[model samples]
Target: MILRTSRLDLREMTEDDLPALRAILQDAETMTAYEGAFDEEMVQAWLHRMRDRYRDDGFGMWAVVLRESGEMIGQCGPTVQHILDEDVLEVGYLFNRAHWHRGYATEAAAAVRDHVFRALGADRLFAQVRDMNVASMNVAIRLGMTVRGRFVKNYRGVDMPHLAFAIDAPPTGREHGVSAAPPERRRER
Candidate 1:
C-alpha cells in the first residue's frame, strides 16, 4: 500500500530500506526523542518490528519518500500505543535531521490523520509528544489536536514526560483532505 501526498508517498518499508533507515534512526540528533541513536542490532530490530506491525496490525509507520527524489526522507503514520493504561491509535512522525525545518512532518501527518478518520473510520486520532519536543507538538497542533492529558513514559531506561494530544473526526466524517489523495495498494499479503 502507498499513501500519496502532494510531495510524498508513504508506503510499507522493505528490508532494502535499511541503509536509509539507518541514516535516520542511527543519527544521534534525529533520535534524541528516542533517548539516543540506535545501534546496528537495535536498528535491525526496529525494522523487523515495523514489518511485524504490518502483518499483525495492517498498518505502521511507513517510509516517507519524496516523490521527486524517491528518497526515504522520514517515517510517519499510525501505531497502536499503550498509553496511560489505554490502548490508543497514535499518529507519529520522525524525520532525518537534514529534512527538518521544512513542513514535511505536518503535511505527512495530516495526510495520515485524514486517512484514519476517513478510510479507517476512526472517531479520534492521538499523538504523544515528549514534553521538551515543541517541534513535534507543533505538528500535532497543525493537525488540529489539543492536549488532552499527560503521563510519564518510561522508555530507554528513563522517565520521560509526554503530553497526550488528540483530535476527533470532524462531524462530516472528513476534512478538506490534504491526505485524501488516492493510494495505490494491492490486497495485503
Candidate 2:
C-alpha cells in the first residue's frame, strides 16, 4: 500500500481497477462536478492519463480502497493542475455514490494531504473546487484549506467557475485550523 489509514488504503490504480473506476466515473450522480458521467472512451483516456502521471511525476490520482473489504471506493490524490495560469499541486477526491456522505472523501484526502506534505516535499497544497460543488468544497475545508482565489475552468465543453483552496504545510501537523483529525498513519509515499 502507498499509504494507509485506519479504514482505508491509498495505492496506485492498475488496469484491473477499470471496472471499479467505471462504477465511480460512469455514474451520473457521482460525476456531477465533472459535467456528467464519462463514456467508455473518456474513462479509458482518464486511466491512461493517470498512468502517465504516475510514470512521469511519481504520483497521481490513486485508488482509495476499503481496507476491510479490499474494495475500491474512490479516487483521491494529487495532480499537476494549472489554476489561474500557475501550475500547482492539487489534491482531488471523487467517490462512488454509494460511499457518499460517509467521510471517506475527507479521510482519503486527509491522508493524501499529509502524504504530499511529508513525502512529496510540497510546501503548499491546493484543491480547485467547482463553485457549485458544496460537498467537495466541504471536503477541501475539512482538509484545512481556505479559498485563495477563483478561476474559470473549461472541461467537457463546460466553462466551470471554481474556487481555489489551499493551505501551507504545517510543521506541527496539528495546525490545519480545522476540527477533522489527520489519519493516525500515512507513513508511506
Candidate 3:
C-alpha cells in the first residue's frame, strides 16, 4: 500500500531498500538515539523481519520516499512492541541525518496515524521515545499525542527513561469546533 503526503510517498519495504536502510541503521550518529548501530547482516535481517511483519499483521513500517526524486529517506509507521507487559501498537520512525529537520518524519507520521485510525480502525496509537531524544519527542507531540506515562526502557542492557504518548479515538465534532447533528427522531421538523 502506498500513502502519500504533501512532501513524501510512503510505501512498503522492498528488497531494493535494504542498502538505504542499512546505511541509516549503521550510522552511529543516527543510531545513537536508538539502541545502537547494526551490522550489515543485522540490517538485512531487520529488512526481512519488517517484510514479514507486513504480511502477518497487515501493517508495518513504511519506507518514506521523496516524491520528486524517488529517494528513500527513511521509515515511519506502526509496530507491535512487547514492552512493559502485553503488546502495544506504537508509531516509530527513523530518518537519515540529511533528512532531519525537514519535517519529513512529522509529515510521514501523520499519514501513518490517519491510516491506522481511518483505515485500520485503531482505537489508539502510541509512541515510545527515549528521554534524551528531544527531536523525536517533538515529532510525537506534533502528531497530537499527549504524554501518557513514563517507564524504564532497557536499551542495549542499559535502563533508560522512556516517555509514552497516545491518541485515543478520532476527534469529535466539538473538539473540531463543529456541532454534531442529532438523530432523526430528535431532529426538529
Candidate 4:
C-alpha cells in the first residue's frame, strides 16, 4: 500500500532501500535512540523479515520517501509487538539523522495512524518509546496517544524504561471539525 502526504510518500520497502536503511540503522546517534546499532547483515535480515510480515499479515512498516527528491527518509507502520502480557499492533518509526527536526516523523506517524484506524479498521494503536527519548514522546502526544503504562526491561540488553501510548479509535467527522456534507451541498450548488 502507498500513502501520500503533501511532501512525503509512504510505500512498501524495496530491495534497493537496503543501502539507505542500513546507513540509517548504523548511525550511532540514531541507534542510540533505538535499541542498538544494526549491522549490514542484520539490516538485510530485518528487511526480509518485514517482507515476510507483509506477505503474512498484509501490513508492515513502510519506507517514507521525500516526494520532491525521491529520497528515503525513514519507515513507519504497524507491527505486532510482543510485550510482557500479550501481542499488540504497535505503530513504530525511525528516521535518518539528516531528516531529524523536520517534522517528518510526526507527519508520517499521523498518516499511518489515520490509515491504521480508517483503512485497517484498527480499534486501537500503540507505541513504545524509551523514556529518554523526549522527541518521540512529543510525537506520541501529537498523534493524540495517551501513555498507558511503562515497563522496566532490557531493551537491547540495556535496562531502560519503555513508555506505551495508545489511541482507542479513529476520530469521526465531527471530531475533526469537518462537516458531514460538502460545502456546495450544505449550501446550494
Candidate 5:
C-alpha cells in the first residue's frame, strides 16, 4: 500500500530495504527506546517477519520515504498487538536518528492513523508508548489520541512500562487540526 503526505511516501517494506532498515534499527542511539539495538541477524529476521505479516495479515509497518530526496527515513503503520491483555490495532513507528525532530514521525503516524480508520474501517486505533519515550508520546498526542492507561511489557528480560493512547475514527470528515476548506485548499493529496 502507498500513502502520501505533504513530505513522505509510505509503502510496503521489501527485502531491498534491509540496508536502510538496519541503519535505523541497528543504531544503538536510534533504538534506545527499546532495550538495545538489533543485530544484523535480527534485522534480517525483522524484515522477514514484516514480509510474512504482509502475506498473513495483509497489513504491516511500512517504509517511510522522503519524497524529495527519495531516502527512507523510517517505518510506520498498523499492527495487531496485545495491550492491556486485549488485542488492539496499534500504530507503531521508528525513525533514523538523523531524521529525528523533523516531524516525520508525527506526519507518517497521523496518515497511518487516518488509514486505519478511513481505509481499514476500524473504529479506533492505539499506540503503545514506552513510559520513557516522551517524544513518541507527544506524537501520539498530536495524532489526537488520549492517554488511556498504563501497562507493563516484558521485553528481553526487562520490564518496560508503557502508556496506552487511543483515538476513534472521526465522526464524519472531522479530523483534528484539519480545517474545513474548499476543495482546492484541502490537503487530501
Candidate 6:
C-alpha cells in the first residue's frame, strides 16, 4: 500500500530497500535510541520480518521515500506491537540520521495516524517511545498523542523504559466538522 504526504511517500518495503535501510539501521547515531546499531544480517532479518507482517497483518512498517527523487529515506507505518499485555496498533518509524529535524517524521506520522483512523478504522493508535528518545516523543506529541503511561522492555539484555502515547478517533461528524467541510456547508439548516 502506498500513502502520501506532501513531501514523502510511504509504500510497502521490499528487499530492494536494503541498502538505504542499512545506512540508517546500521548507523550507531541513528539507532542510538534503541538497543544499538543493527548488523547486515540483522538488517536483512528486519526486512524479512516486515514482509511477514504485511502478509499476516496486512500492514507493517513501510519504506519512506522522497517523492521527487524516489529515494528510500527510511521506514514508517503501523504495526501490531504487544504492549501492556495486549496487541496494540503502533505507528513505528525510523529515519536516516540525515533526514532528522526536517519535520519528516511528524509529517509522515500524522499521515499514518489518519490512515489508521480513517482507512483502517482503528479506534486508537499508539507510539511506544523510548523514554530518552525526546525527538520521537515530540513527534508523537505533534501527532496529537498524549503519554498514557510508562513501561519497560528488555532489549538486547538491557531494560529500556518507554512511554506509551496514544490518540483516539474523533466521534462521528466530529471528524469532518468545520475545517474538513466548508463552513457554509457545516452551518445548521
lDDT of each: 0.90, 0.92, 0.86, 0.86, 0.91, 0.90
Clashing pairs in 4: none
lDDT of 5 by residue, 1-189 (tens): 479999999999988898899999999988887888999998998888888878888888999999999898999999999998899999999999999999999999999998898889999899999999999999999999999889999987899999999998876545566555666778565
Write down the RMSD of candidate 4 (Cα, Å).
3.7
Error of 5 at 173 (Å): 9.3
Residue-wise C-alpha lDDT for candidate 3, range 1-189, written one tens digit per residue: 479999899889999998789878999889986678989888888888889999999778889999989999999989888645658888899998888998999999999888888888788889888879999999999999999888887766789888888888786466666556655643664
Query: What TM-score would each prediction reach against the true structure?
Result: 0.89, 0.90, 0.87, 0.87, 0.89, 0.91
- Candidate 5 local Cα displacement, residue 74, angstroms: 0.3
For candidate 5, the TM-score is 0.89
Worst 10 residues of 4 by lDDT: 170-179
lDDT agreement of model 2 with the native: 0.92
Per-residue accuracy of model 1 over 15-132 as CA lDDT, tens digit each: 9899999999999988898899999999999889999999999899999999999999999989999776799899989998999988999999999999998888888899999999
- lDDT score, candidate 5: 0.91
User: Positional deviation of 14 in candidate 5, in angstroms?
Assistant: 1.0
Highest lDDT, which number?
Answer: 2
The better-scoring model by lDDT among 1 and 3 is: 1
lDDT of 1: 0.90
lDDT tens digits, residue span 13-45, model 2: 999999999998999988898889999999999
